[model samples]
Target: MEYISFARLIEAVYLPQIIYTVIALTLSCMSSHRSSTSTELLTAATVQVSSDNQSPNSGNPENTYSDIISSSVHNITVIGVYMVIFAIAGNLMCSYFSGDACTIISTYLEIGGGVPVLYSMDISTKIKTALILSLTAFGGLSALFQSRDMIRISGLSFIKYTTGKIVCAFLCFIFYMMCL
Candidate 1:
C-alpha cells in the first residue's frame, strides 16, 4: 500500500481549483488596471478633442474614476463566468473520485469563488466562501439529499433541513445586499 500525503491529496484534489482562483484574482486585478489606464487615456483624449471649448479638467477626473469602477465591474463579470466553470468541474470531479471531503470542498469553493466575482464590492472572499461552506455542511448534516449520504450519519430530518436552508438563504441575501 502507498501513502498519499495530505499535501499531495490537497494538491491532487484542489490543484485546478487553486490555480483557477489565483488566475481569477490576478486577472481581475490586472484587467481592472489595464482597462482603467486604457479607458482613461482614450476617454481623456476624446474629451479633450471634442470639448475644445468645454472644461477638459472636469471631464478628465470624473471619467478617470468612472473608468476604474466600470473596469472593475467588467472584470468581476468575467470572473463570475470562470467561477461557474470551476463549479461544474468540481461537481464532475466529485462524481468521478468519490471523495466526500473533496466533493464538499469543491462545492463550497463554488460559492467562495463568487466573492472575487463580486470583488469590486466590499465583501471578502473568505466571508463568501465560508458562508457557502457553512450552509452546505449544515444542509448535508440535515440530509438535504438523502441519497447523497453514501456514508450515513444519523440525526437529520427534512423539517430541520428546510429551516436551515431558509435561514441560510435569508442570511445570504442580507450579506449580498450589504456587499451591494
Candidate 2:
C-alpha cells in the first residue's frame, strides 16, 4: 500500500481550496468596494428625504431594525425553499440510477455521503485520488446550495464563482497528476 504523509494529505485537500477562496475574496472585495460607493450615494439621498419629511416612523430605529430582520427572514426562507427543491430533485435522480452510476451522482450531489461510496469502490488509486481532489475543489451541489445566500449577500456573480470552482477542480486534478 502506498502511504501518504499528513502534510501531503493536508496540502492535497486544502491547498486548492485556499487558493481559490483567496482569489474569489479579493475579486469580491474589489467589486463590492466599487459598488458600495454608488450604493452609499443612493442611500444618502434617500435618507436625506426621510430626514427632511420629519416622518417619525421613517426615522424610528426600532422600525428600521424590524424591517431588516424581516427582510433577512424572507431571504432565509427563499434559500431554504431552494435547498428543499434541490434535495428532492437529487433524491429522485439518485433513486433512478443504480450501482456505480448512483454512486457517481451521489458524489456530485453530496460529498459527505459520497466519500464512503468512493472508498468502497474497486477503482484504481489514481482515479480515486483524482476524483477526491477534484470533487473537494468543486465542493458538490450541497456546497453550492449552502453558499447561495453568501454569494447573494456578497453581490458576487454566481456564474463567475462556479467557473472559478471548475477551474480550481481542473487545477487540483492537474496538480495531483503531476505529483504522481
- Over 1-180, each residue of candidate 2 has an lDDT whose tens digit, in order, gives 566677876677667778878976687578977568647756765676557556467768898788779878987887666556656666677788777667666676666655666777887777777777777877877678778766754545577777887778777877776774
State how far residue 11 of model 1 sits from its true place (Å). 31
Backbone clashes in each candidate structure, one number apiece?
0, 0
> Candidate 1 — which residues are off by over 4 angstroms?
1-62, 112-180
Candidate 1 lDDT, tens digit per residue, 129-150?
Answer: 4344344333322233322232
Worst 10 residues of 2 by lDDT: 148-157
Question: What clash pairs does model 1 have?
Answer: none
RMSD of each: 20.8, 6.5
Cα error of candidate 1 at position 178, Å:
31
Q: What is the RMSD, in Å, between candidate 2 and the native fold over all Cα? A: 6.5
Model 2: what TM-score? 0.59
